[model samples]
Target chain A: MFEAYLTLMVFGVVSVGFAVASLIGAWLLRPRVPDPIKATTYECGVEAVGSTEIKTNFRFYVVALLFVIFDVEALFVIPWAVSAKTMDIGFVVGEMMVFLAVLFAGLMYAWKKGALVWD
Target chain B: MSETNRENVKNSGEDSQGSAQAPVPGVAKPSIPAAAHAKPAAAAARPAAKPAAPAEVLPEPRLNNGRGRLLGSARLWPTEVWPNPWARPSFVRGAYWLAGIVAGVLLLGWSVGEISVWANLAYDWAMNLLRLRQVPELWAQGAWSAVKVVVVFHLVALAPLFLVWWERKISAHMQSRLGPMYVGGFHGWAQTIADGIKLMLKEDVSPRAADAWIHLLAPIVAAAPAVLAFAPVYFGSGLTAADIDIGVLYIFAVSGMTVIGIVMAGWGSGNKFSLLGGLRAGAQLVSYELPRTFSVIPVILLVGSLNLTAINDFQSGYWLGFIPRWFIFYPVMGQIAFVIFLIASVAETNRIPFDIPEAESELVAGFHTEYSGMKFSLFFFAEYAYVFLSSALVATFFLGGGNAPLPFLRIWPSWLWFFAKTGLIAFCFLWFRWTFPRFRVDRLMDFNWKFLLPWSFANIAFGAVYLFL
Candidate 1:
């Protein structure tokens, strides 16, 4: 298991090195020709208007919140799914059904609260 | 500027002279009057911009010919460009085509046979030659690990080049056009190489208002996770770079980091389109990821291990002497889970129908819009690499990674089988890109939440009951 992780670590270092190397290669090969017009933010030829960091729809925030809830739910689900195969089938089924039922109820609540509905 | 002025004068003189005559017999009149009027107004506004007209009256019939038709259609095609000779077959071309096919088959056969085994032996011999007497075991192990890392890197780097080229060819053929016909010897094999060189040579642009550090780091972040995700993927029996116990979990957790890079690109660019693209990517990837993760649960339950090799091993035996026990073949629930996994994979990779984040018509290239040169190519590389990784996972989980269909036919190497299965899955991805239209943002969210999410949940429930039975 530790060896497996070591492989991942080596791959990570190598990948970062490769990315940096490619970037450096591009920097060396590319021409540096900067102009005010060229460096300006592209907005389909029109001059950009207003700030980009405006308030977005609350719907996106709601999605983020839902994702957090469900992601945590998944964190619980995987181990159960794996170990459940070796446990008593009836008991495992009953327990998972209960867990899923509560999760389903939460989804329903969010749906009713208009959190899932994108305006 | 002076050249454009002269061209404008030439265009206006031709347009006015052409419009003064009777309308063409069958052609539809040009739709926009503003375009017709603007040309003459420019001519009137700047008298010096106009060229002196020769007394010679060129035949007005030139406007009604093929050139006129091309202009009227509002499409750009240079009439002077020579038609590709490959479109027509000569004896030499046919012979070359036949030779290429034969060579490809021979190469495939060689790779599936002694070539790979010999390559491994050669590497081991080289390592043995370099081994120190003091710590031979440690030295050998370190060298082997280095070799493994190099192989993984090669897979991560080179696979995308082939996949990108294959995607272009596949998508082009699907749409009835020739893709990359001229670059390399046969069917533009070196097109991606040329593109890579061009990308490196082009000016690397960053917006003046953009955050320089985050903008530069975003591509690295985006690309690194894709490379890391390959760690747990098994290429063949005993051929994994890292055979971790929590292989599935590791892959999902790492691939999830790609969203951070996209979000950083969006936020760092200081462009509303980039931010919107990034937010949409985050939301879409997050939403679809649930179903993608859940879809794998059924496979895990059936296989009884989180290790990818274990899952692959579980699918190896025949069910009834003829049918292979692939997870996808497990009655009803397995099929449901596979279908859900495939759809979610499509959305996760931001392909057609779920490509809202970078919808060219809407977002103007999305999160990486401000990026150019190598920075832009990094995102392109990461996307194709993800496609490969996703297809490899699909093959491993569902289609039986590196497992032959028939027990009697086991001559080919296991890695070849794995790649063949992956190629088929990757082809399906390309096919879907060419076949489907982009989904609307609301509709995309609805399909995931309303349709795929519920189905994935149901698939898990069905798997539980099926396993119990």
Candidate 2:
């Protein structure tokens, strides 16, 4: 176990060493000639003008919100899932059928509301 | 200053002129050692290693990624610059030295520790061999364990450059062009190494408005975990990182943290482009993370344990002589889980068709836009490393982790078989990277939520019912 730890440390150090060495090696060799034009971010051939903080479109957050809610709800269902088969087959089967039905109901609700649409 | 400027311009222009002439085009035969000659020749010609050549004359690698549409514009992929805003000219070298030592020590110490454990294990097993009349198959486990450490980590460590080379080769072939045919024998195999040396020689800049510490830490943050995540995956036949109980979970958590690093990288750079890129990545990873985790849940449920080793044990044998017992072959939920996991895994890694975070088009190389030098390379390498890691993981979770593909081939040994499987999956990853165009941010999020999440949950329902039946 200790050996594993040691190996990891050595690996980490070597990898990081390579990363830093490359950065520094290049730094030492490359010229540092910064100008207003040179320093600006490249956006195709156009020059960078000002801060890039234009307001984002609202579409992203709405879809993201729906994604999170649905995604999380799925996590909650996992424990119930694994143990389902060995339980009373009818009760278990019926319960999941209803569970999925309710879940789909909400999804249908969202779909009708146009919340998932990107455009 | 005037003398230095003249030297910079003359030497720098000379270097740039060199690389353009020898790029390996398509249909390459294995290369002869031309770079071997050029390195010594170039160095001898510029022995002084003059500091900071003029920017215009500096030899920048003008890459033709391929003749494809993505390759044509992918120059939009993030190029780094130096003389950053957060730097004071006088303190630069000192900063590099200090930062280098701290990072180097931590990483080296950790890797050495992992290796030492295997060495000790081998010693103990060898000493006990005379007393314990062991079967060779059982004893082979130890040897396999040791190989696992080296091949999984070392191969994974090095494979990215090859994959990048392969990507170039593939795109070149697809576009009816030549790939890297020069440097490092017969292919542009040495190109990545050369590029590595070049980047090291390059300077890192902390943009003027950037938060200095985060700017410095972002690449490290993005990259270090990419390497660390390799701890859980064993590349050999029957080997792994000492079989962590939370093996798959360990992968999930560590891989997830890469997003945090990416966000830090983007936000710290203080570029609008970088910030937007960071946000896209943050949003993308966080959004997909749920489905990705959910995909694994079914397999865990079926296996009845979180331990990757235990999971592998369960899947190792064939039910009959003809039937392989890999978990993906389980009933409907198992099949759904497999599909969900593959798609979600790809998205979680922020691969092509899902790479909105670093979307080159709208975001302009997105996060780390201001980063240059080795810092930039970290992000690039980490992308490939994580891709390999994820593919290995998917192979582990669904297909038998170290089982041979043919039922009869089990006689050949396990670790080799494991590597072969993981390697094939990894190639598929690179194939996908070159083959597809990226998904739009909105479309990407929608797919994860609408498609993957629901499918996984549906799989969950099927799993619950199957468990009862």
Candidate 3:
């Protein structure tokens, strides 16, 4: 297990290095023709107005919140999923079914409360 | 000043061109009068602009979109582009191509004998020449790891060059136009190479208001995660970079880091559109990620292992003498899981019909709006790499990694089978781009949370029931 992870570490370094190398190569080759006009933010050729740090829709936050809940649910589910076939089948199935039922109820509650409504 | 004027002319011309292309016979005849009136109005509005007479007289070629009478004007199918056997009803051309491909593969298998024999022998000979038994065991292992790293790095670096050109050609053919016919002789094979050179030679620009450090780091952060995720992906028998026990989870965890890079690019740009695009990407990716993970649970449950190699080994052999025992062959549960995974994968890659994050018309190239030249290309490469990664995952998880579909086809090398499956699925990714319309942002979120998520959950339950019974 550690051996595989050791290889993965090497791969990680190489992947990041490749990106940095390409950027360095581009830096070497690319022409530097700096212009004040080019430096302004792109807003359809017009003078860019207003701050980008303004408030956004709350729907995004709600989705993010829902994602957190489901994602943690996945953490538990994966271990059980991998071991389910080897364990006593009926008991394993029963346990997962009940777990899913509670999650399903949560999903339904979120749905009914209109957290899923996009408009 | 000259550059700004030229841009004005170009934008005006494009707006007029939209009206010019609108009068395509059948769909909306009401637009004909408006289109006809708009031409003179456009010319009158801009006297300095070029003469509209030449563009008006040149008749656009009407497309013949296969069998469907209604679909002829839609331009959804590539009926007119390819040399089809049936001239009139061209919609069934896809079916013929599918049959031809299957037949060609069977013939090749019959003629080539056993490819695995030659491949394995070649591998063994190379290993023997290395004399690894004489060296320290750790050093020999390091050497092997280095080789895998080099190959995967180059593959990640270079695949986008091919995929970008392939996408251009695919999109062009579907729209009944020739894409890059002249560059580098026959069929523009070296078009992307020329493009890379051009992009490298161009000036790199960062907006004055942008966060300098974040803007600089964003592309590197974005590009690296996709490359790192390729470590555990099995290419063939003994072809994996690292045969980790939790290969599937490793890929998911690593690739998820891309969202931060995107968000950084968005926020760092100091542009509202980029920020909006970044927020959408964050919400959309996180929402769809749930379904993508859940869809693969059934596969894990049935196989009883998180290791992709183990999954591949289990999928070998026949179910009823002829049928392969691939996870995709496991009744309704399998089909549902495969489809959910496929859709989620498409969304994850930011492809249409789920590409609102970078909706060009709405967001002006989205999160990368402030990026230019080589920096822009890194983001471009990251997108294509993700496309390749998702297709490979699809091949591994459902289509059985490197396993052959039929008994006789087993003669071919497993690496060949792995790549063949990956290529087919990647083609579907390209096909869907031109075939479907973009989803509205709201509907995109709703579909994931409401439709795909629930079905994926139910499918897991069904998978358990099937396994127990």
Number of clashes recorded per candidate? 0, 64, 1
lDDT of 2 at B63: 64
TM-score of each: 0.82, 0.68, 0.81
Please give the C-alpha DockQ score of model 2: 0.19
Interface root mean square deviation per prediction: 1.1, 5.0, 1.0
Go through the candidates in order and give each one's C-alpha lDDT.
0.83, 0.67, 0.83
Of the two candidates 1 and 2, the one with more favorable lDDT, higher being better, is: 1
Residue-level lDDT of model 2, residues B1-469, one tens digit each, is 1233334435655562343233332322222254543553344234233333323433433466455333354434444344773464424864777699667755554344334356568756764673376646434454445554555557766878777787787778778666776667645778887877777667666566677788877777777678767775755433555456556666676777788889898878768888888878877788778777777776776676666777778787776665678878887766788777777778777788788877777777878678887788888888888777877787787778777666766654455556556767777776777788888767886787688767766776676555555
Candidate 1 local lDDT, B324-365, one digit each (tens)? 889888888889988999999999998897899999998999
> Which interface RMSD does candidate 3 score?
1.0
lDDT of 3 by residue, A1-119 (tens): 76687789889889888888888889999989889998988999899888887888899889889999999999899999998878899998999999998999999999999999987
Please, what are the lDDT tens digits per residue for candidate 3 over residues B86-143?
5545447656766997888867755754554554576577567667457666666676
Error of 3 at B455 (Å): 0.7
TM-score of chain A of each: 0.94, 0.66, 0.95
Worst 10-residue lDDT window, candidate 3 chain A: A1-10
